[model samples]
Target: MTDLASFPELLAGYFEIPIDEPGAKAVSDPYGSVRVDVGVIRQEVRSPGYLVSGLVYDVSTGLVESVVAPTQVPTG
Candidate 1:
């Protein structure tokens, strides 16, 4: 089973294509597909680490939603 805790990292990596390649549009997984909107990625700094968040437009529902919580990586 896929651990729920790893979803943030999984989603963060899944968005890599669209983030790197400007021409990229959509992506797919076992659940479904979503249109990547690189502009929505948000980042913020916290005390012990930083958080990066992003959202995707669902192809089926046509609604934007967060696939995972902001990924938090400790700096120390």
Candidate 2:
């Protein structure tokens, strides 16, 4: 397991699937309640946006996987 404290330069950012996108529909009573977070772990502030980069740890394999690569996301 890697310690998150090792990368002080990185900031935590949560990325979720857009509500309007497919597969974001609610499974229960409330419509559009089932939002999913892609789980972006760290990013770098780039003024107008953030440089998104993150990894997912698979407990089944006990390995780290890269889900979201370095990409720029607009804040607006």
- lDDT string for model 1 (1-76, tens) is 1232234445446555433442233233422232233223322233455565565656688988875556664443
Models 1 onward score TM values of 0.29, 0.33
CA lDDT, every prediction? Answer: 0.43, 0.38
lDDT of 2 by residue, 1-76 (tens): 1342233233122123343332232222121221123222222243465566555656688988665566675453
Stretches of candidate 1 off by over 4 Å are 1-27, 30-49
Positional deviation of residue 10's Cα in model 2 after best superposition, in angstroms: 32
Highest-TM-score candidate: 2
Give each model's clash number.
0, 0
